[model samples]
Target: MPDKDAGTPRVFLVRHGETEWTISGRYTGRSDIPLTPDGEHQVSSSAGVIVGPGRIIDPSKITHLFISPRTRARRTYELLFDESAQKMIEGKSETTEDIREWEYGAYEGLLTAHIRAARKERGLDKERPWNIWVDGCEEGESADEVSNRLDSIIAKIREIQGPYMHGEKGADVVLIAHGHILRAFAKRWIGFPLSTSLPMMLEPGAVGVLSYEHHKVDEPAFLLGVNMGGSR
Candidate 1:
């Protein structure tokens, strides 16, 4: 494939709007949750920050609008664009399993407090039996597990920037996905330990822009922008 980024594709990753579980701080895994009325509005209004009046980004300039196959992500994309505009990205939006949220497994949908109570009852203190980072699902993935899973997706983005986009220039890969995974994305991209993922929490409909102006991955990829305000 020809490189699409002769001049490094600027990447802007957008987390989807709110879900009922999200507002409650529950662990939402592969459980396809839909956005609430507020979430729909949030995505609609804030989306323009990327493409509309802010005009910081041009919708047509995007080479790819990668979206999780999860309903929330897809729904956000659909609602963010008007009928005609939706058609542009609807056809181009890529379904990426890697962009899916962290797997909550047995605890999926259980609020944090409830899970903590259950964990205490089970005698599974801070330490998870298996790798919580990987096996977070009922037999699903953990934080570290998900981060590694995203590796391929990240690599694919890099590949798009290189010889593919035009030769070592990254392209704009806008991802619309859930919260935990997005936080994990930021953590891993910076080569921080998965535990580090704990410190940063991304809310729904947040806009996070990660770019590597540096010559090498070892070099720090400036945050560019992190957790910008949302529609709400």
Candidate 2:
């Protein structure tokens, strides 16, 4: 396949692999759940395909690694890279609270059905229903709150990618975090409102790419698809 955006800086949004809560459809926020055995396998398999030279996410080309301060995300990082790649990542990685999962608060660890039922009992969603994008959790981070922090991260990334987007090499940034926040990050990356439902899905252990159109930092956009061929 031809290189569509060759030498352009990119942002890789990686969602942590499956966990107990993920299987149960629970809202895993501040809770630090470990990845299941299958989760580890999932990320490792993904690494084989994407984390190599000339692949979608070449570890040596990664300039910055912003990871969530959660156990699952941390472990996912470990599984996503081999010893050599991890060595390449040194001095470029930061474990930050800014990329942590959305603070679920009252709804933490609760399934969506249960959360809505509880809210109904409390007479909270009479007009419509509890929607995280609009209603937010009773005590959790609002959509605006999530957007604010993600904006900060995006600003930092744009600064890092500024001089490199123009055909310069080795400036890809990677973010390892949970479902909702990564989706929110993508939305905010393109200056979209969080209330605008994300039509794209970032599955566990799946990777999403964001980059500039025409190799211009001012033209940030989602890299909708890439064909990961057999090996690097």
Candidate 3:
């Protein structure tokens, strides 16, 4: 909570560790699945290396954390920060529905290939592939709705970090959530449409950084190809 030197404020997007559905490639929206044993180990190993001083995420610099309401995301957050660091953020974390996985609705437990095959059988998309960005889920959220919610979250983040950006140090906001929502959040973070030509992918137990270029809040960009390290 202490203000530091002025710098470009950053938002760290962390995709939750592996779950049964994640390994099987099923749509896991709104499901309260727990992390696998390997998944737990993956995140626990990352905590010490990537979250301390002179690391990708300095624990002291994280002002706030937004976590999804799902068990997977919450468990990932717990495994990614050790006991003392968790104590420091005891009152700083908020579990939010906004940060939850993209609602899969009718397609909740279905895999992508299964959904596509079902669509073809039902005469939905027989010619081309079913793209989530374009086709979306049968009864779930649309691209526009997802974009709107993420934009609102981004605005709230700026509201908290705006004052610190111009000072000597910047604030850091961390988000612990699912794969699709995190990617969509990053896409909207840089003012890009959900159907950007360049796609972004995040592995289980991975971290991605989003910040402004040239220290200007208006110039948002992703820190591409820069390995934060200690993530699997």
Give lDDT tens digits, candidate 1, residues 73-114.
988877666676665555657887878877777877787677
Candidate 2's C-alpha runs over 4 A off are 1-4, 229-232
Note the Cα lDDT for every prediction shown: 0.66, 0.88, 0.82
Candidate 3: misplaced stretches above 4 Å?
1-6, 166-170, 225-232
TM-score for each model: 0.79, 0.95, 0.91
Error of 3 at 102 (Å): 0.5
Q: What is the lDDT of residue 126 in candidate 2?
A: 93
The top-ranked prediction according to TM-score is: 2
**What lDDT does model 3 reach?**
0.82
Instruction: State how far residue 143 of model 1 sits from its true place (Å).
Output: 3.1
Collision pairs in model 2: none
Cα error, residue 218 of model 1, in Å, equals 5.9
Model 1 spans > 4 angstroms off:
1-8, 87-91, 126-138, 163-170, 215-222, 226-232
- Ranking of all predicted structures according to TM-score, beginning with the best and ending with the worst: 2, 3, 1
Residue 152 Cα positional deviation in candidate 1, in Å, after optimal superposition: 0.9
For each of the candidates, the C-alpha root-mean-square deviation to the true structure, in angstroms, is: 5.7, 1.8, 4.1
Candidate 2: C-alpha lDDT: 0.88
How well is each residue in 19-134 modelled by candidate 3, as lDDT tens digits?
Answer: 99889999999878899998887787777668866567766677889999999898988888878778766787989999888888899989889988888888887678888987
